[model samples]
Target chain A: MAETAHAASREHFGSTSRRDSWWLAPGLVAAGLLLLGGYATWAALQGTHFEFGRYLSPLYSPKIAAPWWPLSPALLILIPPLLFRSTCYYYRKAYYRAFFLDPVACAVGELNRGKYTGETGFPFVLQNLHRFAFYLAFLWLFFLWHDVWDAFWFDGRFGVGLGTLVILASTGTLTLYTFSCHSFRHLVGGKLDCFSCTAAARGRHGAWLGVSALNEHHMGFAWISLVSVCFADFYVRLLSMGVFHDVRLL
Target chain B: MPEAVLHVYRGDASGGGLKEYRVPLEEGMVVLDAIHHIQGHQAPDLAVRWNCKAAKCGSCSAEVNGKPKLLCKTRMDALPPGQPVVVQPLKAFPIVKDLVTDVQWNYEVNKRIPPFTPKPNAEWRWKQEDVDRVQEFRKCIECFLCQDVCHVLRSHGRTDAFAGPRFLVRVAGLEMHPMDALNRTKFLKEDAGIGLCNITKCCTEVCPEDITITDNAIIPLKERVVDDHYDPVRMLVRLVTGKKKGE
Candidate 1:
């Protein structure tokens, strides 16, 4: 037998060849998530600047009624979107790879810590909550649209401002992200065996195709929506904090 | 004949690198044909594993230009003309030689799966609708391309815990089988680590068999696991009635 050098023996915790900076993506994701999470936590705890003249920060949408509750209202308001994001199919991959260093990237080595327990255990198993979260997330969209509707009316008169446009863009992108959910896609038409059978099924199949098209760019939606939400909150916070004046376009 | 540059990985277990070979491409040459040319003309000691020149046997699985594909099916014309097509072994498993990795782990995992068991003296008749769904899973040629592409195995090296998408499809075939009696839910949840799959659908994309792996096989199976293990009402019913929910 000829002495052949096997590539598997060169296996290590990461890639060998000196490629362009591979860590940049996961690094950015980690930093972005951290900034978002940290800001949300602080903003939630403050719980005061969530509402400005006509626009309510998404972090405090549906304005939890229980003011006397021990925790921040942001906690309650955040539940739907948080669960949605935490259980999001794309977000799970993003955070898992970015935060947990779960193999980091394709063809890259990962931390080999014996048999992988997967999501069978305590914390990881909670990811199954994503489907239930999808329900809450779907319902939450109504609240956001209502917020957008409220954004149009400044003190009961129909008008559009920079805040209105900002909120509109935020909700629009977030709607795209929410509709493009893997679970939502499945609910739309993924479970159907036949698309041509019956008018309703056909309609659903068409809807599914539309959602699937959006689902293709789900990762892009996830990131953009995240930024949009943060920006909306920041804009509202600026208005609320009196740091920046709301530019009236009407 | 047009010439194409092939950057084939030449070394083994200790260490190796990409060794370029120039091969004259025929009118309708596939990647495996070019590798054969390299073996015959330039490097007689070249180690390459192949079975059917047709795409049936699944033995010609390799990474062609950073994508998992069957060499016999990958047409040279489909690849870019200027760049050297990089051919390497599957990234998930241990490499035994050049292009072949030790895929025996998949076979072992197969052994652990309980064979299809029918209810005692039950009618063998099955609805075509049921057969149709399971038939999609049966279409798998066991190329292990799905396995190679799955990030859980390919990137994470979680072979011990997570059975890659290939076995999940196998499990889906058995679980969805109309006549099969035994429930594989426990095995799927605990042993196979079905929960690990976030359903990215990467496996479905790489499937030459065109199996909708994520939607059909993995998601449905994940739902089963949730129903069996996670549902509060189902848990209470199982505790009180002492009967499995789906059965």
Candidate 2:
């Protein structure tokens, strides 16, 4: 074989022979993650202004009514959903490249060289908790949907408001994100060695195909849900702060 | 007659650079056709590896204008007009000559992966969905465009540690096989270095077969690895039930 380690081919950080604008993707991802992440952190810090007459911020959904807890209510309920997003297979790829600059784009040089440990070591090994987080996120969806249900009940009567739509969008996207999770897909169809071996396996095979189709768009759902969750919170916050009246669409 | 300028790389591991040639353009001429024109009319010694011009054989893999692509699939007219079309060897491998790199490393990686081993007295039956699931991975042509685009091999030069997306797809086919009994998760975790793939998905982007390499193969394989190596809950369940890992 011709020599494997050709010295000229090894590129330094952010360097490559690639001619296209390679930085555009990782740059945009970083900016978006930071912006949204910042907003989530800020919103979580404020315990007040998270609820509007009938609607509740998704960030504070299934609202923890424990007055004994000293911090923002959002902080207590946000951990599992936060862990879900953090350890997500798609987000790991996105943030690893975008935030860590671990080859910010494919074939692009990165800050770390041969010293890479990937997810095999400390801290990153925690990423394996993704499935556990997936379960939590899946269960968390019920509370969000309940909040959406609440958003429709105004003045003890059923009525649709813009806040209802906003909360619904948040819950809907979160549901898509949860159902389309890589771990969920694997649990549904991927674990089986023989789909034809059993009737249940055959059923799982069908479910797997559906989840596989959804998994293809998991990254899109991840981004859209991120934005939708924040937007829902912001909308509710505005209403609760009396900055705007809830526009009834009933 | 309209002609296109081609800057084909010409040299070996010691070093080399792109050599320009002009070829007459045809209605549907591909990059491989232009290279053939250069070989026949201009430079007979201009070495290039190609088996089938149909793009299915995958022997015509190279970087065209800094993009990993099959030369047979990339049409001449599809590229930017009036600019030199550059063809070079795959960056991840060692150069043997002009536009031909040592892809032997890929074959070596393939040999390391255990092939499908069926269970004892296992039923041969499997559903269409199982076929459909593994079939996507079976479509890989071994072009190594995925390997060429993979940063672990191309940039990090961690061929010692990482098995690129191509083999991951290969393993996915075997691992997901209905009757296969082999537990290759140990090989995946320790040797294949499945952890190294961050899954930015350029392999999926450059694939001519349109294989969902990242989403279908790598991620699922990684999830399996998690089941074996990382999931303490699964481990505890196995312990409580007195069941083996794969069972």
Clashes of each: 5, 0
**Which pairs clash in model 2?**
none
Task: Provide all candidates' interface root-mean-square deviations.
Answer: 7.1, 3.0
lDDT, candidate 1, at A132: 81
TM-score per candidate, chains pooled: 0.77, 0.95
CA lDDT for candidate 2: 0.86
Candidate whose DockQ is highest: 2
Backbone collision tally, model 2: 0
User: Per-residue CA lDDT of candidate 1, range A52-161, in tens?
Assistant: 88899988888768957887788878978988998887787778778777656554566766655557677888876667888898899899999999999978899998
- Lowest-scoring 10 consecutive residues by lDDT in candidate 2 chain B? B122-131
TM-score of chain B of each: 0.96, 0.97
Worst 10 residues of 1 chain B by lDDT: B124-133
